[model samples]
Target: MAIVSTSTSAFYERARAGMKDLRSQAETLQAQLGSGQKLTRSSDDPVAAARLRTLSRLESLSTIDKTNANRANADLTLADSAMSNMSNSIIRAQELATQAASTTLTHSQRAGIAEELAQIHDDLYALANSRDSSGHALFGGNNTGNAYTLDAGGNAQYIGSNTSAELPIGDGQSVTRSMTGRQLFNFTDANGNDTDVMATIKTLAAALTSGTADPAAAANDALGSLKTGLDTLSTAQTVVGTRLAWLDVVSERRTSLSELRSTEEADLGGTDIASTVAQLQQTLTVLEASQASFTKLSGLSLFDNLR
Candidate 1:
């Protein structure tokens, strides 16, 4: 065989470089174990890192969607409760109207019933102007002000938008956040004339208190319109209930999607502890062996070998 020679310094340099590489590998594996992440930088796994970025962005958007859904849920729930109260008030008004329609009641007694009806009108107006969880008008649609405004004649007029605001709930879906006061309080009467609950009640109260030729006739006339108004209110309540149920479904879907994203995120970046620890242990063993060999070799000289 031909003689091959390497200088002591060159041999030492080669050994040190090999040891340095082994130590770097060991440190990398140790870091993976400590941090519980497979990637130290985007360059480590560009494809996975890009996917992770997309997932993170989606998570942020989903958070916003959840918040919006919660707000819509709260607003709709408030509207439902307020409408229930309104229904109760309408039922009470119907009872009073029945009492006023009786010819046996004295004029003073009919006047007392009219006073109660007027109070019910005021109560209904307050309910129509009920505030949402955010302190905004519940039945005002997107308007920040009261849903109904009082005119010079003391009549309640709808001042809100025709339709409520829609909120995004994720996956390209949206829901109307609330119903407008006009939708609940206003309806077509039996005579084909457009009328509102507040106006009808106000007129009936006035007729009763004014000592008209026939107070019972006025009360009888209002009964048909009040019944129609109550039907309208009940229908609106059903709509609100349906929307609330839809929100619940959307929320559950969002939660499932979020869980799926989390699972994908963990799969993409999370470190395998058992595999990383095994690699670290193997690297340390090799490094220790190399170090011991270098120490023994460096201490020996040609003269000492001969001796």
Candidate 2:
């Protein structure tokens, strides 16, 4: 009788422990199904967890790269718009100079044209010092201040850096994000003279208004300088357009890399739904059977008949 009682107690303890284990297994499977992830903790799968960490780091870097690319693209877009306006202003200056060069125009008429040229110069100066979305000078070249400033003599001066700013868009890859005033507005003319567009316009305006020399000759010289200004603008536009195209290419590559990282992460961390569900079902069934058997065994006592 003693041996039988000891055996029964051992059976009950073993059955209870088994049910507890089954319950724990069921919970694990349920959590995985709900979360749709196989490895919640590092202990769940060490190798897979390590791989996920790496993929996450790469994904973070990709996000940063994308942001930088977008910012660079936006700054370049602003620069392009400003350059377009500058081109239009230069063309208008050409027309005004042509009119002034006519022997038919009077002194007052020539002075009036110079007055309009001065306004265009002011507008170009403002445009050159235009700000980006972040309020930094668009052509400042790493400077947060204005790209061009007016001197005491009213000449437009380049206050920005010599080299334009660059942004990193990928691993070991960078793109020019800004232009310098020196590159866009300060260019050499056909005569190899270092002339700023605004300075040239100012000089021409003063010459036209001076009334001391032949207005036609002054107008002709200004027209040549304006042509040089147009060429310089065209070159800058080409450079900006090329950079924009390069940004597109880099963006495409970033998207592709992002997709690859996502795939790798899914393969490493995602759950096997079908297999997990089957395991949960099996655990539930075994737990229920064990509970029913334990209940029946607990009620069957040798002392019950004696009572």
State every prediction's TM-score relative to the real structure: 0.93, 0.91
Off by over 4 Å in 1: 1-7
- 55-96 in candidate 1: lDDT tens per residue? 999999999999999999999999999999999999998999
Off by over 4 Å in 2: 297-307
Poorest lDDT segment (10 consecutive residues) of candidate 2: 182-191
| Candidate 1 backbone collisions, by pair | none
As for candidate 2, its clashing pairs are none
Residue 221 lDDT in candidate 2: 85
Best by lDDT: 1
Q: What is the C-alpha lDDT of each candidate?
A: 0.92, 0.89
